[model samples]
Target: MEERARTEEEEMTLEEAFVRLDGMVERLETRGIPLEESFQIYKEGMELLKKCNDKIDTVEKKMLQVNKSGEYSEF
Candidate 1:
């Protein structure tokens, strides 16, 4: 199930993931959602968090890959 969701997330941009995650947070905080739906949102939020972290890690790795001249380079 998670693998399937991850596959879907691959098609989403980092910004998209952040937007969706933020919306989910707002919904969870301000609305009275059902227990089951809340759990579903929680699962989706976890996936988004993982996706965002992975994106940040990838960017950090690329940023760290610098040449001796201090310019970015392929790792």
Candidate 2:
């Protein structure tokens, strides 16, 4: 069988990722969890945060492209 890669949508959109991360924060702040579980939640939240940041950076680059000069020049 051929191997397959996961799609970005299959993983999680930046919005979805942020929502989950926010949930993690609420859980940590208001609802206490076992130390072990807290670490896992924090780790997962960090990973999601990276994905959201990456998406934001991609959007910023595209915006810069749209705000180009006379013509689209290589950066």
Candidate 3:
């Protein structure tokens, strides 16, 4: 069966996104896709990048320690 492009709202793990982005890069480097499809793939890769960044930011925030006084700050 053919695989369809994933929508931004679709749930995907960071590793999965990275794999997809890598595939997109390889396809772009090979340079056989039409201009429109290339643009679409590029856009999807960008969205995946943003998702990865957001996940990292969330992990960073979670790593912060909270003091006994209820005050908290990121390390």
Q: For residues 24-74, write the lDDT of model 1, one tens digit per residue.
A: 988888666888888889988997888889888887777757688989776
State the weakest 10-residue window (summed lDDT) of model 2: 1-10
Ranking by TM-score: 1, 3, 2
Worst 10 residues of 3 by lDDT: 1-10
Candidate 2 lDDT over 1-75, as tens digits, reads 112222542367777777777889998886658898888888867866777788878777766332345565323
Candidate 2, lDDT over the whole model: 0.69
List of clashing residue pairs for candidate 1: none
Model 3: CA > 4 A from native: 1-10, 65-74
Q: Which candidate achieves the best lDDT against the true structure?
A: 1
Q: Write the per-residue lDDT of candidate 3 for residues 1-75, one digit (tens) a residue.
A: 114445542467888878888999999887578998888889878977987898888888778688888898776
Shift of residue 12 alpha carbon in model 3, Å? 1.6
Q: Any runs in candidate 1 off by more than 4 Å, and if so which?
A: 1-5, 64-75
TM-score of 1: 0.71
Cα displacement (angstroms), candidate 1, residue 30, comes to 3.3
Please identify which of the two predictions, 1 or 2, would achieve the higher lDDT against the true structure: 1
Look at candidate 3 and tell me the lDDT of residue 72: 82
